[model samples]
Target: MPLGQPLRLGRHSVFPPLLMAPMLDITNRAFRTLVRGYGGCGLFYTEMLNARRLPTESAQSPFWQGLGVERDVMVQLLGDDPEALARSVERLLPLDPFGFDWNLGCARKKITHWGWGAALLENPQATARGLRALRQATDKPLTVKIRLPEHGHPDLFKSFIKLLENEGVDAITVHARTAADGFKRPARWDAIAQVKSWTKVPVIGNGDVQSAADAQAMFQKTGCDAVMIGRGAVGKPYLFKTIINQASGATEPAPEAAKVLEAMLTCLDTALETPKGAREFKVFCRYFAQTLPVPHWFWAPLQSMTLGPELAKRARVFFKK
Candidate 1:
């Protein structure tokens, strides 16, 4: 059928519940702005911000600079310190985001080494304390993005699910893969189905959804309340708009190469506004390059160009051909 229904997060409601998944280094202001410009994604997420550093992050830093592109965005936090996370939430309260989502799905070594993200799944006590702290920290909508249990940790996974509901999570977005599976394994959408059976909280299914058809299948098969698109949205910012329109029996014009080129450059220009923006622009291009006729041939060129104006000119030339 259609993508899925609108999702409620405490006091907030996001209609047409197709969400953009929280991707570190990828879901910045320029990228979210590009996706929102296309329309379809009901809710968006910031790159997972380190909770401890968030409270002290400079407003002028690249991280904070990109957060203002849209409203109805969720601030995703990563860390193990309850008190620090509480402070971070307090700082974000004034921004009036759609809500806050605690991340329990990242498997990155740098993060898990700190006993945060996916590592918390096996550490119930810490997870409970962190969740409880977040609940007490914000009156705004509070949620989480999580993974299935790790190998041989079935009991731990079940308890983590129970803990989420017990601690008052407004919603849970299941990445639908074990922490060990990483991206090397195809996503287990079936796992999302299982989470639906265990938790009463609204479930948003994420993983391997690259199109409207995939979203439809996830909704039908998992009975999830929403579908979240991650890497799939990188190449085509218009993918969400297309998915939403298809559900309505309407067709959206494929974004023109020139238009996509212009959008990336605009974001690059925005990135160039900050001292550290060049790195963000490069990270952004690695994905945007996928839209080019020959991604392999163009990625190096895109990555090599550092100045926004020069890159914009070259992009126009390359895309026009």
Candidate 2:
């Protein structure tokens, strides 16, 4: 079957319902722009910004710079402080993002120690209070991304999500693993379908989606409102187009190596616009390398170059037939 209808995020509607997942350092402006060129992704997310730190972040910091502001971008927030997050949302309101998503799926000890991310699974009351604070602060579409609770009955999980809906959350993206499970276990699509059955709010299923077929299967298997692409989109943004086409019952071959090289070059040039952009270029290329038919042919030289310009030049020469 073709992909479902447009997904409504409060007043906003995103067609095709394929989203580029909120990756910490990878989903910056340059990368989102590169993905946009290939088409299919309906929404882009900023790197998860620290809600408490956002007020103090410099206007020129990498966190604030080189972002795809033109697209339907969702600015994701990470933190446990309800008041601080409300303050941060107030500050961010002027940017006019399509929405905001709370990060409740990150399992890193550094974040969990602060009672944030996956740790919030242990304190549903905090999650409720934070969402209430955010709801009071803005009329923008507010959502949360979560891992399944590390310890909870299915009924408890359902009640927690019901609390989110009551607090005015526009949607929820479930990562399908419990906090303790991290990514070691396969994503439980069965559980995602169960979550879908529990709530009226649009559910976006994330995790283990690596290709067009996988995207199609996630939607079919889970009956989710959408599917999110994370690690899979790093090098293959065109993967979105593939999924979209396949979902529509049309088929398109993956892009040629030359086209992929051109998009990667564009990403490099865009990253070079900022101060530490060379490092950004390297990070993007590191993932972009994996998309190649024989990645090792280009990985060594890409890895050796430290300067963005040099990397771009070598990439051109290497990809040249």
Candidate 3:
């Protein structure tokens, strides 16, 4: 797949080449809808769901909660057990999602200890077997999210990628850093370029894409098919529009702080429909604070408030400045 081309991933084809990365606790249905409202995100992924929990009947389960079938959403599952992962996919298929993604790039310690998330990257054979199981279990498009090798062993990385390709993964999103490196190290765009050289499958480069210029630079440097924005999309939903405009040689009005706040409030309203409405609102507010120019005096009080209306009023007041 070339950098500016439409890449087919099983039943779906993504154009303009962008995806909203599956962010834990952040990329919920409400946030995905908010990004979609801004326009230009080619695909949207839900937050990572534990494969084990998907079988249980719980209202709070991320898999069961806040799922809106109307949007282009891919549900991401995290688990080390091949059977458990496969069974989870079978259960999720009835929802008729755009596709499914296996998460192999989260570096959180709890997930790593369970042999899930980025720990799967340490064992290429296990990862390949898991992919095979997932491929056989469901006809939906299968994608994997991976991080760059910490030891920089190109041969081993290529072998792992080849296993995914052989197993018929629709696409792969590379976070561009090793699990050990976390988010601190700069994304290795050159490594993505190397992967692009080796694979014909759609390769989506992810990491540190904060602006349209950053997206352009990643495309220019890596020659990958698409760009996936994670934290950068938070409090800045218009980022997708900006990137698309830049790619098409057009310009858009810069997103003002007030508009960003209004979007956050809209996201809050949607999130409130879910079980952990209050807690999720707090998480969203924390990120929104980062995007606003409000003083700590304003944010501190708002964070401590239990009332949603109070928080919204405070946010509006701060944004008006």
Task: Go through the candidates in order and give each one's C-alpha lDDT.
Answer: 0.82, 0.82, 0.79
Off by over 4 Å in 2: 66-69, 268-270, 273-275, 291-306, 313-321
Each candidate's number of clashing pairs is 0, 1, 0
Whose TM-score is higher: candidate 2's or candidate 3's?
3
Cα lDDT tens digits for candidate 1, 110-131:
8889999988888889988998
TM-score of 3: 0.91
Predicted candidate 3: what Cα RMSD to the true structure? Answer: 2.6
Among all candidates shown, the one with the greatest TM-score: 1
lDDT of 2 by residue, 14-53 (tens): 8879999998767887788888888999998888899989
RMSD, each candidate, Å?
Answer: 2.0, 2.5, 2.6
- Local lDDT at 203 for model 3: 90
C-alpha positional error of residue 149 in candidate 2 after TM-score superposition, expressed in Å:
1.9
Winner on lDDT between 1 and 3 is 1
**Any runs in candidate 3 off by more than 4 Å, and if so which?**
1-3, 59-68, 273-275, 291-294
